[model samples]
Every structure is written in C-alpha cells, then in structure tokens.
Target: MTLYRQLIIFTVVLFLLLFTGTWYAKLANTRTFLTDQLESHVQDTATSLALSVSPHVAQKDLTTVEGMINALFDRGYYQRITYTDPRGEVLIDRTLPVKVEDVPQWFVKLVPLKTPEAEADVMAGWNQGGTILVKSHPGYAYETLWNEVISMTVWFAGCAVFMLAAVGIGLKLLLKPLAAVERQADALGRGEYELQDPLPRTREFKSVAEAMNRMTVKVKEMFGEQAARAEGLQERAYHDPLTGIGNRRYFETQVGADLGEGQGRGLLILARVHALEALNTERGLQAGDELLKRVALLLQEAVSGYGDAVLSRLTGGDFGIFLPHHSSAEAEIVATEIASELGRLARERLSLSDNIANLGVAAYEGSVTLSRLLSEADLALSAAQSKGANGWELRAVSGESALPMGQQQWKESLVKALEERRVTLDAQAVIANTKERGVRQLELFARIAQEDGTALDAALFLPIAERLKLVSAIDRMVIEEALRFDFRSIGVERIAVNISPTSLEDEAFRGWLHGYLKGLPAGAPHINFEFSEFAAVQHLEMIREFAAAVRACGHGIGLDHYGRSFSKLGYLKSLRPEYVKIDRAYTGELLSGENDSGFYVASLCSVAHSIDIAVVAEGVESEEQAAVLKELNLDAMQGYFFGRPRPLSSFTAA
Candidate 1:
C-alpha cells in the first residue's frame, strides 16, 4: 500500500482500540451506578412502608392495613411487594408478571439487572407484627442502559468517520512529496533527470527529496562532463581549436553531403589572412592568433541564420565558409559581409597599413568533388588577390538551378501546390540492421509536384518554402497524406513522417496537427514524427512537450541526422526519443575499416539503447558498411543499399 493508505489504516486502528477501551469503561461504571441506585431505592421503600404499616398493625385494624397495602401496590414502581404474618403466612401480596412489557428478553438476558429485594419488620407497639418485603422493577434501568449505549455508539461512529476523513487527507498531503521523489527515481532510470520542487516540510520527506535533488544534479554534471569529453574528442578529429570551428576534415564531409543531385547549391567562400605571418614576426604569434579568431567570428556571423552553414579553419591563416542553398547574389552578400568586417578589423587594429584580407566565392550546382570545388574557390581567391588586398571575387559553375523560378514564381507555385494538394508522398524502407527482422518502418519523404510533371524533392524547395513561410502548410499536407495511407492494405504496421523544425515552433500549426491527429482512421499506421537532431538538441524542452502530445495518438517521435551538429548528446539522455538516425558521414567511413567512427557508433548506440532508443544508420551504401553497423548492434538503416525512396504506392513490404 502507499504511505498515505498505510498511515490512514494505522490511525483508524489505534482510534478503534482506544475508543473500544473508553466505551467499555464507561458502560461498566454506568451499570454499577444503576445497580446501586436500584438496591438503595428498594431498601428505602420497604423500610418506609413498614413504618407506615406499624400503626395499622398496632391497632389490629385489618381493614386499614389491607387498604394501605392495596394503595402501595397500586403504584407501578415496585415489581413485587408482600406483607407476611408473624407465623410467616402472607397477609397481602402483589407481584409482577413473568414477562415485563416494553423490555426485550435478549437485552435483559445479555445485561441482566438484579433488583435486590428488601424486608422490614412491621412492628406493633412492643412486638413484631409481620414483615414487609419490596423489590424494585428492572424495566426502567434496562431502558436507561439501552439509551446510553445507543448514544455512545452513535457518537463514537460519528467521531470515527470524521477522524478517518481528516487523517486520510492529512496522509495524502504528507506523502505527496514522496510521490514526486518516486517519479524522479523513475525518470533517472529512463536516462532522464527530473528534479523535485517545493521541498516538503516534514523532516524525513525533506531529507529524502534533498538527497534526490543532489543525485539529479550530480548525474547532470556527469553527463555534461561526458558529453564535453565526447565533443572534445570529436573536435580534435574535425575542428580547429584556436578558431573554435570545423577543421578541414569536417568541411570535406559537408561538401560531399551537399554534392548529390537535387541537393541545393552552395557557395564555398575561402578567406585568407594577408598579413598574418608579418603580424607574428612584428608583434607576436599571439597577435596573429587574435586576428585569426576575429576573422573566424566574422565568418561565423556572416552565415548565422542559415542552419546548414559551416565555418571551418583549414590552416593557420585560411578559413572557409560553406553557405548552402544560396545563389551567386546570396553568396555575394556573404562575401561583402566578410569584406566589410575584415576592413573594419584592419582599420581598427592593423593601423590601416597592413594587408587586410582576400575572399573567393565559388558556387556549385550539382555533384562535384571536394578537391575540384576547393581548387575552383582557391583559383577565385588568387584572382581576387591579383587586384590587391581586400578584394573579393565570385566563381559560379553552371548547372540546373535549385530554384530556377524567381521568388514570386516560387511562392505562386508552392501556394498552388498546397491548394491543389499537388504533392507526392514517398516511403523509404528502413531495413533491420540484421536479418532477424524484416523492414523496420516506412519513412515518408514529401515532394511538391510541379505543373510540368516534375516533383521537386524537399531539398530543392524547402529553403524557398521557408522564405515564403509555407513550409508548415507543406508539412501539414504531408502529415495528412501519410495519415490517409491505408496501412492494412499496404500490409505495414508503422509509418514515419518528417516534420519541419520551423513548423514545430509554430503554435497554430501544432494546434492543427494535434487536433487533426485525433480523426485518423482505425487502420492508420502508427505514425512516428521525426525532427532533425540539430533541431531536437536546440529545442529540447519544447520537443519533449510535443512528443508527449503526439504519443497520445499512439504515435512516436525520433531524431534524424542525429550526431551531425557536434552538439552535446546530453539531450538524448533526457528527451529519450524513440530512435536516432546517425548521419551518413560516419557510415561512409565504415567501408575503410580503419576509422574511429566505429567506436563512436558503438558509444552512441550504447547511450541511446540504454534509454530504449533504437539507432538507425542513414546512407548505408555497401554490404560491408551494413556488416560493420550490424556488428555494432545498429537497430536499423536506410539508403540505396536497402531501397531508394519511392512513391508510397510502390511500397510492397510491411
């Protein structure tokens, strides 16, 4: 039983024992008092009656004596009254019936009242005439005892009921803190740390709560330290410590990831510090290092709003910024920003006499090798340097435009698509990492079909949709379409849908989503809502609230592109998502069999699985990679190696 229940029971039992003892004592005392009163009353009555009869007996007036006896017997107070002659013969006698009226036999038998009989001599002037006997009736005494018992029982019951209610409420309040403590423990078990608030006043409860809070703090610190260590390890592998940004290795992966067809174009801006070597020689290496950090900050600021932007220090004085989903004009904006910041830095700190900076912007359209792309950007940098310091140039390589249409045209097309529901929903199979299980779940990807019969993938239109603020509508459509899917006919039990991170922050969109989810068909797939790991980490608390709301409809939530941002993985330990998709960079390295990525995947899996989360490896392109991941105990995977994303109607496996 709960502490509250136990406390109430104990309280009631103690009250019962005390009340029983008290009632028994009162009943015994009352019974003794009543018996004494009855005995004294009978004795007094018999003596007084004998005194009155003495005059009659002395006169030997048999008629008067008989008349006085008859008058006394007429009163109902006596059960029996008798006058005996000197020879022990009865002169006058009166007695009550065997069974008295208005008194129960069982009650009398249970609490028998013995009315004592008394005898007094009826004396003549000098001789004893006869004896007068009187005994009191027990009916009145029985009635008094019965009424007393009824009153005592009713009062005891009322007090017991009131006491029980008061104690029950008191116990519940006292144990409320204990319930919170229990929840905190459960949260900890599930890889989450939930702290208790409003400490209890009770000493024992307060102590326990304090201990639990301390434990929560310690665990949070431990996870933070561990995450810091992991992130540090990651940085050492792919980041420049002094610049506090991505190193060359990381830039390479970003370039490769954005190289696929239909993946939006991006500009690689290469900025080199012109007088860094001279600054080190003239002042100190510290001054040169400070310059590099300033430039890094400027580069970081230039691409602040672009979620996919990456800044990295390739060498001591060379830095790179990759701005994805931007045109030459957009790239020029970044280049101009860099030029302005560098000019300010030179004017303020370099005495206006030092060489400032040089920037080269090279934009790519389709698949391109990192070496070739970087070389083109470098060539542009050299061309800009030919003019002098503080010069910038842009090199655009031609291919299909991620968005060939203008801003207005793009908006019109998207709005039309939304209104007409000109959208296609596709599912990519997330196969089990091992052969024991078949297909994991169907992950839905959306495409907005244009009038010309070309369906643009989200990568091609998402940025433009964001600019138009229409991404949420598209997301809603995708959700509706996924819910419309006939799960039974498709022979699938689950479907996974991706949500725009931006839309999650939209209040109206969320309200609509939850309200719409309630109307899903009975045979609809158990939907899984997915957010990028970057978004999940950024909005940890909000996502937790959203996840709870989504799960109310028997759906689940997860993170995709997990482990991409190099942010602390501590959120995973708290949010406790249903699954996590490890980005393809780590998976791609598995083919070589020499990367430390395998160890990273193992650690990631261990942490995720400890919280009952499954890990899915994205972009598994080879059997060897799959084998390595399976060995790492990966739960699932999705890529061309399994099956490429296709229209939902084309999906055959459950």
Candidate 2:
C-alpha cells in the first residue's frame, strides 16, 4: 500500500483505541454515580415515610397506613414500600417488580444498576409501631446512562471522520514534492534533464530534492560534454576550417563510397579560381582568403535548392561539388549559375582577374573510381581555361552516357508514371546481429519501371518529384503498395517505408495517411514511416504531429541517414523515433581497428539507447565492418552484405 493509505489506517486504529478506552471509563463512572443515587433515594424515602406513618400507627388507623403506603407505591419512584405492626405482623404492604424501561436488555445485563432497599421503624410515642421498607427503581438511572452514551458516541464518530479527511488532504499536500522528484528521475532515465521546482519545507525532503537537482544537472553536463567531444572530433577530421563545409578528405570518402556502390547517376563539378597566386601577390593573403570565402558562399547559394549536394575546398584555389542523382542537362544550368555568380564577384572587386573562375562539369553513372572522374573533370577544366574568361564545360567519360532527360522531361515522366501506377516495390531486410540472425524488418524502396524495362530507384527520381511538387503522390502510392504486401507469407511482423517531410506538409496527404492507417486490418503488419534526419530537423513540428496521429493507429516513425546533418541530438528525446539508421557515410568509416568512427558510433549508440531508441548501422558491406558495428552495440545492420534489394513478392518464410 501507499504511504498515504498506511497513515490513514494507522490514524483510524489509534482513534478507535482512544474511543474504546474513554467510553469504558465513562460507563464505569456513570454506573458508580447511579448506584449511589439509588441508595440515597431509598434511604431518605424510607426514613421520611416512617416518620409520617408513626402518628397514624399510634391511633391504630390501619386504613390510613394502607392509604399512605399505596400513595408512595403509585409514585413509581420506589420499587416497593411496606408497613408492619409493633408485634411483627404486617399492617399494610405494597410491592412492584424490579424492571427497567426504555433501555436495551443487553445494556442492562452488561451494566447492572443496584436497587438498594432501606428500612426505618414506625413508633407510637416511645415504642416501635412498625418497620417501613422502600426500594428505589433502576429504570430512570438506565435511561440517563443510555442517553449520555449515545451522545458521546455520535460526537466521537463525527470528530473521527473530520480528522481523517483533514489528515488525508494534508498528507497529499506534503508529499507533492515526492511526486515531482519521481517525475524528474524518470526524465533523467530518458536522457532528459528536469529539475524539481519549489523546494520542500521539510528538512529531510528538501535535502533529497537538492541532491536530485544537483545530480540531474551533473548528468546533463556530462551528456553535453560527450556530444560536444564527438562532434568536435567529427569536425576536425572532416570539415574545412575556412569555409565550414566538407574538406577534400570528406568529399573523397563520401563521394567515393556512393559511386563505388554504383547506386545511381550524378554529376561532379570542379571549379578553379583563376590567377589566385597573382591576386595574393597584389593584395594580402587576407584579401585572397576573403575572396575565396565569397566564392564558397556564392557556390552554396547557387546550389542551395538542390538536395544532397556536397561542396568542398579541394585545395588552395580548386573547389569541388558533387550532386547525387542529378541529371546532365541540369549540370550546365548549375555550372553557368556558379560561373555567373563568380563574374558578379569580380565586378564587386573581390577578384583582380576578369576571368574569375572556370568550372568543369563531369557526369558519372554506375560504379567508377574517384581518380577517373577527377581526371575527366580536370581535362574539361583545361578546355574551359582555353575558352576565355569565366567559361565552363560539361563532359562525360568515354563509354557511359549521362541521363539525357532535362527538368521538363523528368517532370513529364514522373507525372505519367504516377498516373499509370507504374511503381514497383523493392525491399531489403535489416538483420539483427544476435545469435539468432533474425530479420528485424524490411525497408521498402519505391522503383519506377521505365518503358525500356530499366528500373529507376527513388534516389534517381525523388528529387525531381519533390521539385515538381509530386512527392506526396509518390509517397501515397508507395504507402498504398506497402499496405497491400503479404507480410504473413514472409513471417514478418513489420515493414518501413520512406516518407518525405514535404508530404506531411500537404494537408490532404496527412488526412489520407491517417485514414489509411486507421482502416488497416486487425492483423496487418505495423508500418513505420522513415524521414531523413536532415529533412526531419527542418520540419520537426509537422513530423511530430504526423507521428502522434500515426502512433494512435498502432504505427510508428524512424530516422534515416541519422548523423548526416549537424542537428542537435536533443531533438531525439522529443521525437523518440522507433529507430535511427546511422548514416552510411559514418558506417563507411568503420574499420577493423579502433578509429574515430568507432568512438563516434559508440557515442551515438550510448545517447540513443539511454532514451530506449534503437540504433541501426546501414551500408555494412563487409564482415569486418559488421564485426566492428556489432561491438558498438548496434541493434541491427542493413546493406548488401546481408542481401540486395529484391522484389517484395519474392519474399517467403525464413
């Protein structure tokens, strides 16, 4: 039982004991007082009657003596009154049975009131005439005692009830601080730091609350320190000091990993500032640095609308940009935009040469070495430098042709595909690292089959769809397909589909998603919608609301590419997604020995698991990587090492 109930019960028992003791004492006192009153009443009446009857007895008035005795008996105060002659013969006699009225029989038996009899002589002048006897009635005594007992009991009962209620309320108020302490402890367990407010007055409780507050603050500081250390390590290793973007090392590691996997089509642009050494000789190094910073800012602004575009400082004057899943036709537009911005920078006197920069754009597809792409872009750069001031060029490597479709063609193709319902479902299993090697769940990717029988992954088409405001349509179609899947046949209880944060912004899409989830069959597999961490951070409110609505229908949400953005880890506490798939860029850094990536991954796992969130490492293509991840306390692993993406219909019971 709770302390409140225990205290109330203890109070009740104590009150009952006190009532029992006081009530018994009162009963004993009442019985003693009544017995004395009865004795005195009988003695006084007998003496007075003897005196009154003496005169009558002296005259031998038998009728008068009998009348006097009868008068006293009829009064009912006396139980009996009798008169006798001097020779011991009875002259007049009257008696009534000893009985009590208006009192319970149990009460009378429990407390027997004494009825005392007393006698006095009736004398004629100097001799005794006769002896008169009188006995008092106990009925009046019992009535008085019963009334006092009833009144005392009612008063005690009322007092007990009022005391209990007052005590209960007081206890609840005093214990309010304890409730706050409990909540604070729970929040701490979930990696949330909450302090108890309005310190308690009680000394012991106040001490406890202070200690808890101190501990909470200490733990929060520790978490912040760990997060900062990990982020600092990541920054020093991968980010450029000058521009606050990725350095050449980060670009090679990330872009190489993406192209090595042969995932899809993309473009790489290499821009070199012209005559930077000459400019630095004319001005100071500070001015050259200022000029470079402006160029970086202009490049970032020009491609700000594009998704997953990586810009980096390759060397002193050469910069690199990699756009994943971007078409060749858009490549020229991006190149010319950067070139036009550089020309404006020259006009603003940031550059001494009118030929401020030359951009060499190279398109790539499928698996290829990083060196080959760089070589191709370098040749194109040489061609641009020969052309004139602020010139640019676009080229593709010898055998492979770039994706020929432009923005308008992509819009037309995506719209038609959605209209024709030409989407196909592909799934890859996330396998647990436990001894059972069980499949955790399937991650679904939407693919559009082209007229030539070539399938286009969402990575290749989603950016275009989002740009054309057709992402919600694609998301809706993918969800409908996922729901129609036969999870029972594969013995899988859950599946996850990617969801664009943009889709959640559409009121109609949100309504349809909620309705569809609510109408699912009773035994349908639970659906988990995934949002990239970068996009999720941008639209947290929308995702939070959508998460709440879907969770009401037995669904949940997860974060994909988790560590790709520079968003704070604190949001994870509020978002509380079902799981987070660590970005492949981090996963690609895992090696057999100790490294910064291992420390970073371990830190991520610690932060996530403290809040009961599962951490998954995606893109685990080698046993060494998986073994390294397994030691990092990752909940699951996903990538080609387990299996490649295949048709959902091909899945069967494991």
Candidate 3:
C-alpha cells in the first residue's frame, strides 16, 4: 500500500476508536445521571404526596387519597402507586400497563431504562395511616435519554467530520515530502537523475531526500565511470596508440561491417611510405618512426570533415583511409592533399630525399569482396609508383549509377518541396513490451510529395537532401510540420523525428529550433530529436552540446540506429539520451536463439540500463520477434508487427 493511504487509514481508525470510547463513556454517564435523577424525583414525589393525603387519611377519606393517586397516574407520572396499612395490608393500589411509543425496540433494548420506586410514611395527624410507595415511569426517562444521546452523537459526529478534514489536509501537507521522495525513487529506477527541487522541511523526510540525492549522485558517477572504463578498454583494442586513430583490426571490422550492410559505393585509400626500410637503415629507426607518425597525423587531418570516415594504421609504413559516402573526385582530392602534407613533412622536417609517400585511391560500386578492394588499391599504388616521384593514382569503377538526381536537381526538388510545404509526416508507433493504450513514442517519417503527386519516402530523398547541404532545411520543415500538428488530435503523448548528423553541425538550425520550441504555447507536446549512432559518434561534442540545449527547452533527445557504430558504450553516459532504438540489422538476428547477436543486445541493454537508458528493438515484424526482443529485456520496439507507417492524419482516428 502507498504510505499516504496507510497514514489516512491509520488516522481514520484511530479517530473512530477515540470517538467510540468517548461516546460510550458519555452514554454510560448520562444513563447513570438519568437513573439517579429518576430515583430522587420519585422519592420527593412520594414524600410530598404522603403529606397531602394525610389530611384525607385523618378524616378517614380513603376516596380522596385514591382520587389523588388516580389523578397522578392518569398524568403518566408514576408506573404504580400504593398505600399499605401498618399491618402490611395493601390499602389503595394503582398500576398502569406498559406502553411503548415512537422509540425503536432495538434502542430500547440497547439502552434499557428501568423504573425506580420510592417509599414514604403517610401520617394521620401524628399516627401513620399507611406507607405510600411511588414509582417513576421509564418511558419519559427513555425519551429524554434517547434525545440527549442523539443530540450528543450528532454534535460529536459534526466535530469528528471537522477534525478529520483538518487532520487530513494537515497530514497531506506534512507527508508531501514523502511523496517527493517516492517520485525520486521512481526516477532513479527510470535512470533519470532528477533531483528533489524543494527540500522537505520535515526532518525525517529531509534526511531521506538527502540520502536519496546522495545515492543518485553516486549512481550517476558510477555509471559514468563504468562507461569510461568500457570505452577505454574497447578503444585500446580497436585504436592505434601511436596515431590515436583506428588500428588494422578495427579498420577491417568497420569496413566489413559497412559493406555487409550494403554500402554500394565508397572510396578506399591506402598510402605507403616510400622505402621505409631503407630510410630506417640510413637515418636511424627513430627518424623513420617519427615520419610514420607524422604521416598518420597528416592522413587523419585530411579526413577530418568527412563524417564517419575510418583512418587507420594498417602496418608499420602503410596507412588506410575509408570514406563511406565520398565520390571518386572527393576521395582523390583528399588523397592528393595527404600526399602534399607528407611531401612538406619530409622536405621541411625529416630531410628525406625524394617523395615521402605513394598514394593509391580506389572507388568501388556494388557488393564487392574486401580482397577485391585491396587488390584494386594495390594496382592503383603500382600505377602511382610508375608515375612521377610524388605520385598518386585513382582507380575508379564506371557503369555504377549513384543517386539519379544531381546536386542541382536535388536542390531544386527539395527547395520546391519545402517551399510548397509538400512534406508530410507518416508515423509508426514504438510500443512497450507490455501492451498499453498509447505508444512509447511515435516515430514520424517524413515524406515529400513529388510532381506526379506520389509521395517519396524519406529513405529515398533524405540522403539526397543531406548531400545537397539542404538536410537542415528539410529537418526544420519537418519540425515545423510536426509542431503544427495537434498531438492531442493524433492521440499520442510523444513523437520522435530522425535528425541528420550533418544538421547537428549546423549552428543556424540549432538556433532556429531553440527559438521555434520557445515559441510553442504552454503544454505543447515536445518533439523528440533522434540521431543515428553512426552520425552521433562522428560529432560527439556537437551531439552533447545540442542535446543539452534542446532538452533544456522541454524536448527529448534519443539515439536512432544505436549499437551500429561498433564503438565503446562509454559515450552513452555523457550523451544520456532518453532512449535508444536498436538498428533493424540487429533485430533480424533475433530469430536465432542465444546467438552472438542476442548476447550483444543483452550486453547493450545491460550497459544502457545501468545508465537508465531504455533500449528499444526496431524492425520487429512478427510476434516471435517481438517475444524474443521482449525476452531480451527490451523496453520497447518499433516494427511492422504493430503496423506499417501510416499517414499522420490516420493516427488520430485510430
């Protein structure tokens, strides 16, 4: 039971006990007083009557005495009256049969009032004529006692009601702090570190609040520490200590993973130092080591702005750079720049003869083996070596079509879509493992209306939009559309939208969003901004900064496609998103029982739960999948099992 209810019941029970005890005591006292008064009243009446009848007795007028008794008896003053002679013979006797009126039989039985009899001597001028006995009727006493009892009960009941109201309100106020403490405990369980805003003044509650606050602080710190440790361990395993970039093992895993996900076209650049062994032989190993380190630095610097690129030290004198979405031209430019930096390092500092680097850049299309990519890169390197001293070659695959729309065409199309407000939101529900009336959150997928009046799924155009540098604009438009939506009409508590990592880099977009949210009227539902883990990790600081600012404005921030990054889970503590949506790829693996995929998800959930972040499995298409995900302790899920994404307007009626 809740503490509040327990207290209320206790108070009520105690009040009832006190009221019952007091009422019983007063009832007993009133009955005793009434009974004593009856006895005294009868005695006084008998003595006075005896004296009045004595004159009649002295005149030997028995008829007069009998008349007086008859008069008193008819008035209902006495139950019985009798005059007996000194020889104990009954002279004049009067009795009335019992009659009960109005009062309930139960009341009469519960509070029985008995008649009291009194006796006195009647004198006939100095001699006793006979003894006079009188008894008071209990009917009047019962009526009087019942009325007094009712009045006292009514008064006490009124007082009890008033007292209960006053006490209930006072107790609620006093225990209000405990309510705060209870909420705090729930928040902690939810993985939120919400602090108690107003410290309770009550000493016991204050102590409990302080203790809970302390525990919360400690738990947050502990999760952070755990994340840091895990991040560190994972980084050491995958990262190159010398260059502070990814190592060979990490590089292959990332490239293979991305390829497995069907990244059709991307650039693979491999650079090798020229004659590293000869250099180390001629100019000490330290100088050679320094050159290698410098080259790694330059390669890393060159790939900086290309979001989600992998730079790794493949070997002692070889380094590799992989860009997921770069074109052939862009890859060449980055490689050429890296070549230039190496030339500078060797000529200006290392004092090495000839060009210091040989660059091989290969662009591939469609699904290809990792060995095929490496072979192409090697051929390009050989071709480069055949050229000038500071040489570079690009091996490009033709006949592989990229996005059908060009940059200008995409710009025109998206601009028209935005200007005409052609974009509409289609929503899919993310439901808890437990069934509920509403969803955990509504994932709003943006669709753009084409010239032909057909709507293009966001998946078809968002990449194009991102490439055109208009992703932020589209994102902003989506936000505006969602804001205009009546969430109440849609019957949803929260809605989430996917955010481009490129957009997070836009200061203007963040500013516009802040102002936009600020302009919303009070009690408007907040839009949940979600980012892909792939993009989020690329710009952690940006995500961290933007997340803080946006959440402060009464919105939620979450991770989309979580666990795809293959990075340490350490950043989760820092990002502290409200929840994470597991990528669909992972969800597909749940068909197998106790597999690596399931274990990975379980581990992910463990770390996520430690930080109080809810893990949701996406792409659940069957009951079996849902059941498996739920067994994995996934808090919620989004997939075809619930229903396909429908027009946002349809959600309201649903």
Which candidate tops lDDT?
2
Pairs of colliding residues, candidate 1: none
Clashing pairs in 2: none
Least well predicted 10-residue stretch by lDDT in candidate 3: 397-406
Error of 1 at 170 (Å): 7.4
In order, the Cα lDDT scores of the candidates are 0.81, 0.85, 0.79
Decreasing lDDT order of the candidates? 2, 1, 3
lDDT of 2 by residue, 53-138 (tens): 88988998878888888987898887777776767787677777867888899998988887889999988999888899888888
Task: Evaluate model 3: give its TM-score.
Answer: 0.67
Task: Give per-residue CA lDDT, model 3, range 309-336, as digits (tens).
Answer: 7788898878888886556767768877
Q: How many residue pairs clash in each candidate?
A: 0, 0, 0
- Which structure is stronger by TM-score: 2 or 3? 2
Q: TM-scores for all candidates?
A: 0.74, 0.80, 0.67
Q: Once superposed on the true structure, which residue ranges of model 3 sit more than 4 Å away at CA?
A: 60-110, 119-121, 126-133, 137-184, 192-229, 282-286, 332-354, 364-369, 381-393, 399-405, 412-461, 467-530, 537-603, 612-654
Candidate with better lDDT, 1 vs 2: 2
RMSD after CA superposition, every candidate: 5.8, 5.0, 7.5
Q: Write down the RMSD of candidate 3 (Cα, Å).
A: 7.5
